[model samples]
Target: MTTLHNAEAGDRDRKAFDDPAARGQLIRWFVSAAAISVPQAAGPVTFSLLALVLTGDTSGGAALILAMTVAQVLGAIPITRLGRNRSATWFLQGLIAIRTIALLLMAVLAAYGAPFLWLFLLTAVAGSVHGAAWGYLRSVLNGLTPASKMPRALGISATLNEVTFVLAPVAASGLGSLSPIFAVVAMAVLGAIPALLVPHVSVAPIEDTPHAGGSVLSPSILLWLMCSAAGGSAIAAIEIGAVALAIGFGYPPALAILFTVPLCLASVAGGIWVSVRNRAATRGMVVGLLCVMTGGAWLAAMQHSLALTIVGAVLIGAVLAPLATYYSLILDILAPPNKRPEVFALLRTANAIGIIFASAVLTATSLSVALLVVASTMLVVTLIVGAVSFKEKRRA
Candidate 1:
């Protein structure tokens, strides 16, 4: 571990490329990055589009999302366990190959109007594979990138995901008419490249045998995470409410789209911060982000006037970077380096599950009530976790 990489150290890190180890690691990272990019970019967007094409039903589209979330959670545990004991990277690559095959089938299904359930199930499987790949990439980053530069690496990874979101829509929506599966195939091809790069990452020679501890899930860590997640639920509720409030205020629902504009800008900017500045990844930032995210949501709710909500929306935009960065960093810090693939997948699952709960609330209750319920519950859990973590630290 070292201090922040200042100008000279960063220059050295840059020049470290001449060193064989650094050179090899960078090559591996970029190569895997290419493979991960297409799938990351196209999978969800295309899947939804494909589902709609197959059945012309929005519920089918919704099912694909729910399935992906559920499957990822279910898939992560076994994947992590396997990563710890096996050549998980190569194994993950194999999964990507399977995923590519699935996407192709989905293409066929979409073209011919196959059974809806089959199409949705395949979509879920693809999601599981994507989740597994994500976890693996994060773990690899933790191992290869020096502690001081990990934030930069994390920033690059998060930004890549953002790129995926932007491109998926364009490729699947616009160019999809020409070749629906082209986006998927491109994603699959790129997804597999990272697996090829995995063998290149030199596993540092630590002669010490690993401890096969009791339960891999630490009670304290789980407690903190669950608590954090609970409070964060409010952020989700508020988001839904914000959209409805805007619509009610007679500002077209599209006005809410402006919210993501700043959020996206802030996210990219935040990535640069983590990359260039030596910011210690801390739970404190996570708590702060959640609080701000919730506060923004609440503010938007209170601000029935479109103008006030817009300011709240900007605040919401600001919160995403810290929120995303914190969860990512926490996963990096807590999960063992090699076991990241599964954990990352699991993390996505948690997020998706959270979304599902939020969705349920939206469906069962009015949007405003849903937002209040999610936000209030989340705030309480966040405070409880903060208190517990403080006590634990003091005791330690």
Candidate 2:
């Protein structure tokens, strides 16, 4: 009787150790995150190519991105609110469906040679849900992973996202050579894979509760949002201006992938490093990384050589994952339990606003000028964050 009891106890322990649901949830979330990034990864290169093909100018590309960013900013809060009471899996499914339909419409219009204005309208419609979808994903992640394991999960997700960024452009450029419309349609289809996996993944519903200090206006949250905005602006400047930079350096437009691929690879490396190490970042570390990014942008802007551009890309990319991890960590630590999704939406809103600003500048001025603006924005934000960190330390 004692031997039989021991065997049963060991079996139960093994079962508990390898819970299928937990493992499945992690895999599904990673796939969903990668699927969501497909369009974003393709957008910069594909949209630029589309604009150049249709309007014979790059400004049209910038304008399209600007419209999308504006829509995302305007729609983030409301869309996120709608998901508050619903199942995250279902909400994400619906949003992804909407986005997929919008992309299909754009593809149809592009294939039929529709006017640029119509395409712009469709792009805005697609982007309207982008922030909400992102927020929902973040909330789902919180539900699926324990707080202690969140940093590693987020790091893995970030790495997968960077991998998408590395691969999508190559796919876009290659397919775009045949037809830009085909590339758009392809990305849309790929983006829907995550939605299909939603049914298999379980996400616990978040309960709403009132908290005295949960307001989004808290200084720490605000600071993080500002950092997100600055980071977004710098990244947008690099991505949107990549084609122009490549051409200016006497490289063919098709070779613009050279500008982004290495950057994304470096980001993947950073993310993997963070995941393996399993350490949290301090405000001081975040500020230091921001400084490195700022210096890189400045270096890239000051030099026109390919080598300088690659070096700058490495500098910026090395910090991307760490900065993202730190931002998510801060949000996790500071945001109220009931308000995580809304706060995440606000972060997305800030990023979209920054992208809009960068796109507008790119449209009005030169790529070099836009890069300098990015560098300046980073520097200013870094100083502010550093000051805040110092004050908090002194108080402690």
The models' CA-based lDDT, in order, is: 0.60, 0.80
Model 1 lDDT tens row, 1-396: 245536566666456535787757865775575456575355556666655566664466567767766676677677556656655556667767777777677767766767778877887787676666666665656546654555666666556555555555566666555565565555566566765666534443111224223333666445544643553354355444545765777778766555545545655665566556546556666667666666666666565666666665556556554455666666545555555455566665565566667778887998767766676666676676577667867998
In candidate 2, what are the lDDT values of residues 69-114, reduced to their tens digit? 7888998988888988887778888999998999899988887789
Q: What is the TM-score of each candidate against the true structure?
A: 0.80, 0.86
The stretch of ten residues in a row with the least summed lDDT in candidate 1 is 204-213
Q: Pull out the clashing pairs in model 2.
A: none
**C-alpha RMSD values across all candidates:** 4.5, 5.3
What's the count of clashing pairs in each model shown?
Answer: 11, 0
